[model samples]
Target: MDYKSYPVVENIFGISGLNANLANILMITVCSAIVLLIGVLSARAIQMKPTGMQNVFEWLIDFVKGIINNTMDWKTGERFLGLGLTIFLYILIANLSKLPFVITTEPGHVVWWKAPTDDPLITLTLAAIIIVLTHFYGIKIKGFGGYGKDYFKPVPFLFPLKVIEEFANTLTLGMRLFGNIYAKGILMALLVSLGVSGFFGFFAAALPTIAWQAFSLFIGAIQAFIFLMLTMVYMAHKVADDH
Candidate 1:
C-alpha cells in the first residue's frame, strides 16, 4: 500500500503539520449514517405486536441489556442502554463494511473505502472515548473522593500499577479491534492481487477468498461483541463499589 496516496489534509485547522485521513473520515461518516438510518427505520412506527425491524431492534436492546446486567446492576446500567446499543451497532457495521468489496484508486492504489475500525487512529480514539466516559460516570456515580479512593483500595503501593493499567487497557482495547480488522483487510487484499495475477492464480485464489470472506463475517461480529462486552466490563470496574 502506498500510504502517501491517502487523501490527507495537512496542517489541519491551522495546526502545523497536523494531518487528517480523509478516507477514514469518510468511512466513519458512512457508517454513522447507516446506523442512524437503521435506528430511524426500525423505530419509525410502533406496533401493537412487534414485527420485522421492531423485533430486531427490541432484540438488540435486550442483548445490550443482558451485557449490562452481566457487568453491573440493571438499575445502574439502564441509563447506558442507548450508549451500549449505539456502540454495538456502529462497530458492527464498521467491521462488516469492507467485507463485500474494497475500493481503491488506480496507479497509486490508494484505498478509497474500507472499514474505519481497521485504522489504528479510529480504533484508539474510540477506546480513549470509552475510557474517558468510564471515568466520567465513575465520578458521577461515586463522588470524586470515592472514585479516587478506589485507586488506592486495600493498599497504597499499587497506585502506580493501577495507573499503568488504565493505559494498558486503552491500548489493548483499541489494538485488539484494529489488529483483527487490519489483518483481515491485508489478507483480502493479497487474495485479490493473486486473483488478478493470471488465470491459474485466479483459480487458486477464488476458493480461499470465499472461505476467508465467510469467516470474516463471523470474526467481525465476534469482535464487535467483544468490544461492547469489554466496554461494560471496564465501566463496571470504574463504578461498582465492590471492584
Candidate 2:
C-alpha cells in the first residue's frame, strides 16, 4: 500500500491554516472513556476477598505503588498513586487499541481506526503534560526560588546543560513510545494486507500475525510500565529533596 494513500481527516480553521486530526481526537476520547469505565466498574463493589475486576484493579494499584516506592519514599510518592495508575491504564489501552483489527475506508483507503500512541503528536502531548506537571509539583513542594536554584546546584556552569536535559527528556520519552507503537502498527498493517491478498497468503500470514499480536500485547504493557516508571522518576526528581 502506498503510504501517501493513508487517509487523515483534517479541518483547517482560521487564517493560520491550523488543522486538527479528527481521527486522533476520536480515538483519544474513546480510550479515555474506556479507562474511566474500567475504573468505575472495578471500584463499584468493595470486598475483603477481591475477585474479578476488583482483583485486577487492586493488582494494578499495588504495581503502581511499587513503582512509586522504588523511585521515592512512599510518604512523598503516595500522592501520585492515582496519576501513575491513570497514565498506565490509559497508555496501555491506547497501545492495544488497534491490535484486534484495522479499519479503513474504501475509495481512498483512509485509516479510520488506530492506536493513539501511533501518532507522534499524541505521544508528545502526553510527554509535555507529564513534564509540565512535574514542574508544577516541584514549584508546589519547593518554593519557586528553591526549584529555580536546583538547576545551578553543585556548580553554576551546569545550568545550561540542565535546561537542555529537560528538552531532551521530553523528546526521548515521546519518541520512544511513538517509534515502538508506530513500528508495530506498520508490521500489523503489512500482515493484514498479506492476509487479504489470497487464500494462500492468508494461510501463510495467519499464524505469524497471531503470534506477532501476542508479542505486541506484551510490548504494549512493557511500554506502559516504562512510561509510568519514568514519570515517577521525573516526579521524584522535582518533588523529593533527596533527589
Candidate 3:
C-alpha cells in the first residue's frame, strides 16, 4: 500500500496550542513505560524454575550481553551494557508496537499510538544519541587523542571523508529502521484492503499479515541488534589506537 496514504493518528490532545509532536512523544513515552515495567517485573520476580516469559526475557538479555561481550573489550562492554541493554529493549518494543492489534476507537482518531520508531525524528534522535554516547564512551575509555586518531587512520588526508562517513552511517541506521517499520504498516494496510472475499481475506490476507508481522518482529530485533552492535564496534575501533 502507499504509505503516504495511511491514516496517521494525529493530534490526540485537541489542545489549541500544544506541540503537535506531543502525540508522538506521548506514544514513545508509553511504549518506554511498558518496556520498563516488563523488564523490571521480569528481573524482580526471580525464579529457580523459569516460566516461559521469564525464560524468553532472560534469553534476550543474555543474547544482548553476548553481543556486547563479543564485540567489545570486557572493561568497555561492562560500562556500556546497562545503556546498550536499555537501547535494545526500547527499540524492540517500539518497532513491535507497529504491528496489528494496536487498536483504537473514537472519531478522527486513528491509532492513538503508532510505533515510536516509525517517526523519523524519534529514530534519528535515537541514532544521534547512540552515536554521541559511543563517541563519549570512546573518549572516556581511550582519552581524547585516541578518539581523534581514528578519523585520520592510515592517512591524515582521510579525515574529511571519515567524518562524512560517520554522519552518513548514523543517518542511514536511523532512516533504515524508520523506513522498514513504516513500510510494514503500509503493507498490512494493503492486505486489509485488497477487496477479496471475507474467507479469502482471512486465509489469504490475514494469514500473510500474521507471517509478515512475525517477520517484521524478527526484523525489528535484528535492527536493534545491528544498531547497538555498530555502536560497540565503532567504540572498539576507536579505542584500538592502532586502528
Per-candidate TM equals 0.92, 0.92, 0.83
Off by over 4 Å in 1: 1-16
On lDDT, the stronger of 2 and 3 is 2
lDDT at 225, model 1: 99
Candidate 3 off by > 4 Å? 1-9, 12-18, 47-55, 101-111, 195-204
lDDT of 3 by residue, 89-152 (tens): 8888888877564444455445565788878888888888877876787788778887787777
Question: Which segments of model 2 are wrong by more than 4 Å?
Answer: 1-16
Q: By summed lDDT, which 10 consecutive residues of candidate 2 come out lowest? A: 6-15
Error of 2 at 78 (Å): 0.9
Question: How big is the positional error of residue 153 in model 2, measured in Å on the Cα after superposition?
Answer: 1.8
Query: Residue 214 of model 3: what lDDT?
Result: 79
> Quick one: best TM-score, which candidate?
2
User: Would you give me the overall lDDT of model 3?
Assistant: 0.74
Worst lDDT run of 10 residues, candidate 1, spans 5-14
